[model samples]
Target: MTKDIEQRLKNKDINPTAMRLLVLDFLMQQNAAISLTDLEKGMGPSDRITLYRTLKTFEEKGLVHHIDDGTGTTKYALCMEECDADHHHDLHVHFYCQQCKETFCLPNTQIPEITLPKKFRSEEMNLVIKGVCDQCNPD
Candidate 1:
């Protein structure tokens, strides 16, 4: 697993330092978007400043993308294989569980293509549906 993480870091032109490897490994293992608070707690005895920097670097390199689901806090998840340092193609629907307060990426359900009005420019788009998650709603 460590070797795989190292190779992935190299592929992104990022140095696989101890901290970077740890952060990347954690992100790779998660199925939902995680906030810094959660990451810090999950990563015990880690340097907060270094961890923040590592996450920032990953975001810049497109290894991960931030999800601003109107929570006033940003969550991050591993980007899809289609993403790169220059381009991010991880524009899928995000689900925020109101009960658990967790964020999930619904990659199978894509965002509908839209043609905007003339002179109206759009840069980035994020659609997050808020509700109880499957785990929270045991029906």
Candidate 2:
């Protein structure tokens, strides 16, 4: 499992240090995006600064993408295989479950292209749908 995680980091051009491997392993086990605080809590006894740096490196390498679901806290999740340091093909809709307060990446739901004004340039795009998720929906 550790070897697999190391290979994934290397694929993204990220150095697979001990801490990086540990961080990536933890991220892989998560079913939903997680905030820095949540990651720190889950890592138990880990240095907050080190964890934050690891996450930042992953983001820069396109190994992960951070989501701003309007919850005032940034959450992170793994990026698709097509993502790289130069470009991130993560223009997919994110879902925020109100009941569980968890954010998930709906990778299959691609965001439609929008025509902007001639002088307008788009750098990044994010769309978050807030509602009850399948797990939280009683019906």
Candidate 3:
């Protein structure tokens, strides 16, 4: 498991240090997008600064992508296989559960392409569907 995690980091062009390996492994184990708080609760009693740095590095390297799902906190999830250091092809819909405050990447749901005004230019885009997820929905 550790070897696989290390290899993933290396594949992303990131140095696979011990702390990076540990954080990447933990992130891979999660089923949903997570916040720094979630990671701290799940993977720590580990170093807070190291963990933050690891997450920042991953985001910069396109190993992961973050969603500002309007939950008052940013959530992060693993990027798709095609993501790389140059560009992230993560134009998928994000589902944000209001009750549980968990975010999920809906990989099958592609974001619709938009045509901007002639003077406008666009780069990154995120489409988040906010609702009560199955886990939080009672009905």
How many clashing residue pairs, candidate 1? 0
Question: Every model's Cα RMSD, please?
Answer: 1.1, 0.7, 1.2
Query: Any residue pairs clashing in model 2, and if so which?
Result: none
Model 1 lDDT, residue 57, Cα: 92
Q: Which residue pairs come into collision in candidate 3?
A: none
Q: Please, what is the TM-score per model?
A: 0.94, 0.98, 0.93
- Which sections of candidate 3 miss by over 4 Å? none
Report the number of the highest-lDDT candidate.
2
lDDT of 2 by residue, 24-124 (tens): 99999999999999999999999999999999999999999999999999999999999999899989999999999999999999999999999999999
lDDT of each: 0.90, 0.95, 0.89
Q: Candidate 1: TM-score?
A: 0.94
Model 1 misplaced regions, further than 4 Å: none
Error of 2 at 78 (Å): 0.2
